[model samples]
Target chain A: MEYKVQVIVKPLDAIANPEGKAVERALAALSFDRVTKVRAGKVINFTLEADHPEKARSITEEICQKLLVNPVMEYSEIQISQSGN
Target chain B: MDPIIKIVTFPGTNCEYDVLKQLNFLGADAELIWHQESDLGSCSGIVLPGGFAHGDYLRPGAIARFSPIMEQVIKFAESGGPVIGICNGFQVLTECGLLPGALSKNDRMRFICKTVSCVVKTSGSVLTSAAVAGQTLHLPINHGEGNYVCDEETLKYLRENNLAVLTYTEDVNGSVEQIAGISNKAGNVVGLMPHPERATDPLLGSTDGQVLLRSFIEASK
Candidate 1:
């Protein structure tokens, strides 16, 4: 089975998010004052072959643990869905 | 026999030659090792020079950690061989779990390139063994994401174990506790943001980097 996977990676809340803060300041400079707590992260999407949805999720989780995520500073959220043939 | 040092170069790594030149000048036989090579092949020390490894894709050092050569690098470090990761190489060390903490985007979100004063905090590590505590060395830092961050527990461990080897004289990039470099508990592996290779030449404005690199070369022996 083919599954589509998306991983959302971001710095932990305890870690400083300078890019997010810079974006927030830019937004405020543009007079978008209502926005607060702007945090920035990256999304990675890819497709892979797996025997089942659970297997795909596990594989995605493994990938995140091994490479996609730095547990010291970043966290990742993985989303897996069955791909349409 | 003169100690042999291996400088590992990833595809985007541009500092390999600089490091090679500096190491050779310092009297160690240093060679450039490609990222795909599986074996270190009897080298006394390994260095990961600074650059945008894997083009800094995903993140600095993120993709490079998965390269074939890194497995051997990790094993070498585990076996207590001296290893130092400079700049982006430092990022790779943290990403690979060879060192603690992560290098985050600069606090002001700017790529800073300039010389900074770093105080050696411990001479226990392979990188700082030649310097005494509280000795300040001027080294150049060039990076977009050099801010280092780690959780409190890890910070405490680093502090107690004297693993935090070098710290900035001031907050250069918002690194926690002004830390510019650190070593693993064993003190064989070290990672730092500043470019020691760049400071080896007096013409480049400072010879302070020689102190650190010399320490690493000595440790490799």
Candidate 2:
């Protein structure tokens, strides 16, 4: 089975988010007063081939721990779904 | 024979020549090693020079850390060889777990390019052995993601172990505790955002960088 994996990695809340702050300032300049908090993150999309969705997800989780995310500064969430679903 | 230093160059790396020139001027044999190669070619020391590797895609060093050459670099560092990562090289070091902490985006989201004052916080690492603990050096820094950050526990460990080699005299990028450079526990691997190679000439406004680079060259011998 082919699964589509989407990994979203964001800096920990304790870490500074300058890109997010820049977006917020831009919104404020455009008169969007209600938009208060903005955070920036990275979304990585890839395809995983496995016999089962559970196996694909497990492999992705391992990769996330090893590479896609730095535990010291970022947190990650992985989403997996059947391809073309 | 002069000890050869290998300056590893990724696809997007730009400072390898600068590093090569400086080390050559200091009477060391230095050459660029491509990222795909598994062999280090008899180099005694390794340098990961500055620049946006892999176009700084997926974060600065995230992509470069997976290069085949990195595996060799890691092996060399583990074997107690001297490895220094400057600027984006520092990002690669942290990404590959050679050093502690991550270099986050600058607090103001600006690409800082200027000479900054840094003080040698410790004299134990390969890069700082020629420096006194209280000695200051002026070096050029050019990066957007140079603000080094780590948890309190890691910071405490670095301080207690004398791994924090250099600290900015003033907050240059909002790095934790003003850290400008740090080394691994073994003091064989060191990384910093400032460009010591760019500061080697008096005509360049400072030669303070000689102390650090000289220390590295000597250690590799």
Please report the candidate that would top TM-score against the real structure. Answer: 2
CAPRI tier of model 1? high
Chain B alone: TM-score in each candidate? 0.98, 0.98
Clashing pairs in 2: none
Residue range A1-85, candidate 2, lDDT tens digits: 8899999999899998999999999999999968987999999999999999889989999999877888878999989989984
Candidate 1: C-alpha lDDT: 0.92
DockQ of 2: 0.81
Clash number for each model: 0, 0
Q: Give candidate 2 regions above 4 Å deviation.
A: none
lDDT of 1 by residue, B40-62 (tens): 88789999999999999988999
